[model samples]
Target chain A: MTEKPMNAVSNEAVDSCGCGCGREDLPWSGRGTDLPITGCRFSLYPMTDDFVSIILGALDKTDTSHVWCQSDALSTVYRGKREYVVDAVAALFANAWREGVHMALEGQISRGCPGDVSGDSVLSCEGEAPNASIVAAATQPALAKLSLYPLGVENYIDDIAKVWYRAEELGLNPTSIHYATRVEGSIRDIFAYFNDVCALMERTVSHYVLHFTINVNSPTDEEE
Target chain B: MTEKPMNAVSNEAVDSCGCGCGREDLPWSGRGTDLPITGCRFSLYPMTDDFVSIILGALDKTDTSHVWCQSDALSTVYRGKREYVVDAVAALFANAWREGVHMALEGQISRGCPGDVSGDSVLSCEGEAPNASIVAAATQPALAKLSLYPLGVENYIDDIAKVWYRAEELGLNPTSIHYATRVEGSIRDIFAYFNDVCALMERTVSHYVLHFTINVNSPTDEEE
Candidate 1:
C-alpha cells in the first residue's frame, strides 16, 4: 500500500481500519469519528445607538437547528458541521445588518480539532445549510482581515502564502497586514473565498482555522 | 561588518546609515522615520444593558496623550509607541470593567508595518506609558485567545511553538486552539505574557502581530 501523510486521510478512508478490529474507535488513536467536526466562536458589534437590540435581534433570528450553540458573556460558539457553522455566522451578520449603522464581527472558525470531539455526535445530521438561500441575497460591501493557521504543519508559511495567492487570483487584491491578509469585496465573494481556502487546506492539514475580522457599512468608506 | 538577517536591525542601529549619504530619508527605503511605528485596532463589548455608557466612559477615561486615536464605525485604531499601544488597550479594558458585567475586547496589535507610516510624525514623542499605574491594579479574571503572526518568516510555526512553550513556563496553561492559543489567568499576568511573546518574536521578525480576543468577568465561570 502506498504511504499517505499523517493528516491526509480523507473522511471516507478513516471510516474503517485494517483488519476491522474496531481499533479506530479506541481513544489512543485520537480519531474520534469520521465526521468533519467544525465550529465557530464569534462576537458581533453593531455601531448604533440601539446596539444591544440590534445584537440581540440578530441572534434571535439565527437558525441553529443543525448546530449546538453556547452563548457566553464573551462570545457565542456554534459547533457542528462546517456548512452549518458558516451558515449560522452569515445568518447572524445578515440579520444584524442595518442600512445606516455599520457593523463588525470578529470570529474564529475551526475544523478537526484533535482534542475537541463535542461535535462528533451531531456530525451526521443531514441537510443543506440553513442560510443557503441568503447566499444570493444582495450584500453590502465588506472588508475583512483573515488569518489561517495550519497547526502542527512544518511548512505553515507556504500554506499561508498559497492562500494569499489564491485570494489574489480571485481579484480580491489581498493586502498583506502584520499577521493577516486584508480583502475588500462583496460579502458573497468574501465568504466564497473563505470556503475555498478551507477546502485547499483540509486536504493536507487535519486541524485548521480561519480567524476573520469583518466590517460592513463603514463610515470611512463613505467619506472617501 | 558581518552579514545580518533582514528585519533584525535594532531601533537605535537603524537611526543612521554608514557614510551619512541622506539615503535613509528617501521614500524608496520604505522607512519613513526612526520610530518603531506601533499601532492597535480594537473593539470592546460590555455584556450589559448599560453597555453604551460603560464603553463611552472607558474611552473618556483612557489617556491617549501619547498616541493618535481614530474611531471608525467598526473599531478604534491607536497608533504610536509600542508601550502606549498596549497600555491604551489595558487602560480601556480596566476603565470599562464594571461589577457584575462581563466584558470582552478584540484587538489586533502590530509593529513595523512596511506600508504604514502615519505614526512617523509622533514617533519621537516620549513618555512612560500613561497606563503604567493601572498595570498593578487588581484586575478581574481574564480569559484570552492570542495568535501571533511573524510575516515572511520561513519557519513561522517554529516561532509560534516557541511562544506557546514559553507561555507554559509562565504557568498560563495555554490550550492549543485552531489559529490561536487560549490562556486563562489574572489580567496582569495575561498582558505580561502578551508582552513577552511580542518581545520574543520582534527580535527576528520585522512585522509581527498579536491578535488578541480577551474576556473579563464571564458569567460562565461563576456557573462552574
Candidate 2:
C-alpha cells in the first residue's frame, strides 16, 4: 500500500496555542525557526525470573542518543526533537523484541504549540545550532500520554525501590510505588543530564521497572 | 526497602481459569509449573519524516522470540506464558526507548478460564511437557484490550494494503482498517505460527503499524 507523509497536510489548523496566543506572534516562527520540537517520558517493566539480570543485559545493549534520556526506578524520560525522541524509542523496542523479552511501557509525548513556552528551542545538530532568530519563534506544545503492554509485563512495579533510593538521593521524597522530581536547564542541558542519569541507572541496576513523568517547562519557569 | 515476591500472596482466589476449569486439575498447577502466563499484542506507528526507513531500521534490529509474535501491516500479536511474553516485550521497549524513537501501540491479553478451550493446554518446557491427563483439565479464557498513543502515532492504518495482500493470500477477507484470522491447534502450535508471521512482517517492512485480532479455537471448531 502507498504510504502518505504524516506532515504533508498542513498542521496549521490544529496548531492553535493552548495559552490562546496567536500563531503569528508565537516564538520560533519567523525565518528558519519553525522546526518542530518533541519530547517523551517513559518507563519500562522487565518481566522475568531474573528480571534484574535481564534489565542489566538490556541496558548494556543500549546506545546513547542525541535526545535526553533519563532513568530512575520508576521510569525513563527522553526529550528532544520530536523525530529524534521517537526514533530513539523505536530503536529501543525493536532491539528488545528481537531478544525474546517482555515488558510494559507508559509514556507521554509532547510538541510545541502556538503558546508553548517549554518547547521554544530547536534541537542542535553539531555545527548547525539554533540562533537568536530561531529561538524567538517558539510555539506552544502539544502532548499525548500512552501505555504499552507488550508481552503483558504488567508487574513492572516490582522494582520500585531501586528508583525510590535514587529519588531520595536527589532530595525528592518518594512514595511506595511512585516518585517525583524536576530538572532545570536549557533544552540541551536538560537532555545532557537526562542522558547521564540513564547511563547511571544502566550501570547500577540489573533488572528494573520505572515510571517517569517529564515536564518541559520553560527554563525560566519558577521552580515549585 | 525489601522487595516482596509478587506471587507470594495467594492468587487462588482470583485464579479461576476464565472458562470455569478447576485450577487443581490444570497441568501447570503441580510441581512448580504455576508460573504466571501473561500475554499482549501491539502495533507501532513510527512518526518520522522517514518513518519507513526508521521502521525498517527498527525491524532489522528485532530478534526472534520464544513467545508467539505475529505482525501484518496493521498490528503485531504476541502470546505465550505471561512472563516470557512480557520479558520479550520489555526487552523490545528497552531497546526502542534507548534510541529516542516514538510510536503508538494497541493490543490485548488473555488467559484460560473454565470455558476457554483454546487456552487449556499448559505451556510446557523441556521433558516435563503436559500429558493427556493435564490437557483434560482445560478451562475458559479471560482477556483485556489496550491502546498506546505515544506522540499520537495513532494513524497506524496508513499501510492497510500490506495486510490486505496477506489476507487475500490466506483467503481471508479484510476491512479498510482491520483484518481477522482464526488458528486451530494446540495452544503451542498456534503460537508457533504466530511467531513465524511476525518474523516475516519484520523482514518485509522497515516501519509499520499493525492492528491484529487473534482467536485461538479448538481444532474441532469450523472454519469460516
Candidate 3:
C-alpha cells in the first residue's frame, strides 16, 4: 500500500484494517463542539469536491446516512458499501451545550486531507492531501465521538444548505458547494459515487433494519 | 404615542422621530443599515407565548421551498395555521429576526404602512404598539424606501431554509435562522415595499434573485 504519498494513490492496497490507518478522527479535534477537545487544537481532513457531493446526495436520498454536525467539512468517505464517514463539526459542543455546533474553520473543504486519501473510502477523488502540515492531534474519542447519524436524524439538510449557499453569496467561498457541483468534472464523479452509496444502503441497511427508519430523513428520494 | 424614554426597555425607542412609526427606513436613523436612536440592542425580541406560536408556524411550512432562499411563509402561514411555536431558545431567535425586519426596534409594520398582507406575502406578527399609534402613522405612500419581495419571490427560500435548519442543527439559536429569513424577508419586503413606492422596475431582478442576503458576520452571531 502507498504510505500517505503519491504512490499510495493506486488503491492497490486499501482497506487493510479498521483501526484508522487513514481514518484519523484525531484530526477532528478542536473541530467538534462540546468535546473534551473543545478548545484543543487539531487539524481536520480537508474538504474536497467529492466530500460535499456525497453528503448532499446522501442528505437528499432516503437510504444513505452519515453523522452530520457542521463545524466544517473535514473529509468524506463511502465505506462498507453502505456507510459513509461523516464527522460533524463541533458535535461535542452542540451536544453538551444544547446549541449549534461551532468549529472555527472555513474553506475547510476543497482543502484536502492532511496526509493523503490513504485509500480509506471509495471516493476516487481521494489521494490528494492538503499542503498544510498537522501540528495538533485528535483528542481521544473518549473526549469526543464522531459517528454517522441514522436516517431521519433530525432533518436539517435544508438549513445546512442555506448556510452553505448564504456563506458563498457573502463571498465566504464555503468551498464545500463551489467545488462540489460548480467545479465541472468533480460534480459528475461525486454524483455517481453517492448514487452507488444510496443504492447499497437501500438494498442492504434498509433490509437489515427492515422497518427501523433507515435513511428516515428522506424516504422517497432515490439519491438523498 | 409613548414618548421616547431616556432609559428604555433595551434602548429600542430612543428617537421619537425615526421610530418606524410615522415613517419608514428606521425613521429614527437617517441612513440605511443604521439602527434607530432607540433600537433593540438586545438583538432579540422579548419572548411571550404568542411569539412561540410564530415559531411553530414558521417550521410547519419549511418544506415548500425548492432552494433555501428568502420567500414568504406561504406554506407555513397556511399549513401551520394551528401549529404551536416551540418556546425553546432557538425559536425565540427565529421569531425576533423574522418579525423584527432587520431593524429590531424600527419595524415597518410598527411604522404603520402595513405593506401587503393581501395574501401570505410576508410574516406579520403581533406587535406591542397600540392600533392608534400604528394607524396614525399610516398615510399616503406611508413608510420609507423599504423593500418587500414579490409574494411568490421564493427562488432563494429553500437555500435560506437550509442554512436556517443547519444553524438550528448546529445549535445556533433560531435567531440565526430568523435573521436569515428576515434578511430574505426584508429583501423581499424591501423590494416589495420599494416596488410599491416606485411601482416599477427597469428590468426583471432574476428568476433566482434572492429577495435579500444577510450578513453572517454579524457581531454577535460570531459567538460560535
Evaluate candidate 2 by giving its C-alpha RMSD to the native, one decimal.
Answer: 22.1
Provide DockQ values for all models, in the order shown: 0.09, 0.01, 0.01
Q: Return the top candidate by lDDT.
A: 1
| Candidate 1: segments with Cα more than 4 A from true spot | A1-35, A48-53, A112-121, A152-173, A221-223, B1-39, B45-82, B95-103, B109-127, B134-143, B147-190, B196-209, B216-222
Flag the better candidate by TM-score, 1 or 2: 1
Residue-level lDDT tens digits of model 2 in A160-194: 23332443454333221100122223223323333
State each model's CA lDDT, in order: 0.60, 0.30, 0.19
Task: Please report how far candidate 2 places residue B160 from its true position, in Å.
Answer: 39
Pick by DockQ: which candidate is best?
Answer: 1
Model 3 C-alpha lDDT versus the unseen true structure: 0.19
Docking quality level of the chain pair in candidate 2: incorrect
Mind listing the fnat for each candidate?
0.05, 0.00, 0.00
How would the candidate models be sorted by lDDT, starting from the highest? 1, 2, 3
Q: Write the per-residue lDDT of candidate 3 for residues A1-41, one digit (tens) a residue.
A: 11121111121322211111112122311111111110011
Q: Report backbone clashes per prediction.
A: 0, 89, 73
